[model samples]
Target: MEKQFTLRKNEDFKRVYKKSKHYYNRDFTVLVKNNGVNRPRIGFSISKKVGKAHQRNKLKRRLRSIVYNNYRYINNVDIIIIPKKHTTDFTYDKLKSSLGHVLNKAFKEKKINYVK
Candidate 1:
């Protein structure tokens, strides 16, 4: 992901976690907050509990790909995705579908306000 489309500062993540709405599943969790920007920004976190450094990095890549492919469907929010212990076990396709499912559900419930 591009730097402009990511949450880089510690404060940014903290602000999102403070009052952001969230969605959870066995594989991952998503926290979202209205950013008031024209486009959505995203961040990913994978702890050592999930796996070693390399495994975690691989999972991050898969998750980023899911976001990238679905970029148009998302809008104007800052989102953070945290993988669970078993997330690394999922194939890329499964991961993508699961993320999409959660995001769509949030939209349906009006948790994430759409832009355009």
Candidate 2:
């Protein structure tokens, strides 16, 4: 994801966590909030309990690729993704599908139109 499309500030993540509507599946918990911007912004919260530093970094990279690939289909919102502990064993495709499922569920309820 591009720098402008990423949530980098601590306050930004906190705001999304406290105020956004949440969606969950086995692999991920997604928080979504309208940001009143033209494009969407995303952040990932992978805790130390999930894995070691290298593993966490790798997971973030995979997620970033998935989001980047589907950027055009996303609405103008702030999204924070929290990967569950079970994801430590997930393959790239599994991770991608899991996140996609949660995102679709969240956006669908909000009446946001986006191509899958």
Return the top candidate by lDDT.
2
Query: In every candidate, how many clashes are there?
Result: 0, 0
Q: Which ten residues in a row have the lowest lDDT in candidate 2?
A: 107-116
TM for every model, in the order presented, reads 0.89, 0.92
In candidate 2, what are the lDDT values of residues 1-116, reduced to their tens digit? 67999999999998998899989998899999999989899999999999999889988898888888887877679999899877878898888888888888898866654324
Q: In the order shown, what is each candidate's alpha-carbon RMSD?
A: 3.1, 1.7
Off by over 4 Å in 2: 110-116
After best superposition, candidate 1 residue 27: deviation in angstroms? 1.3
66-93: candidate 1 lDDT, tens digit per residue: 7776666667789998888987889987
Question: Considering every candidate listed, which one attains the maximal TM-score?
Answer: 2
Error of 2 at 86 (Å): 1.8
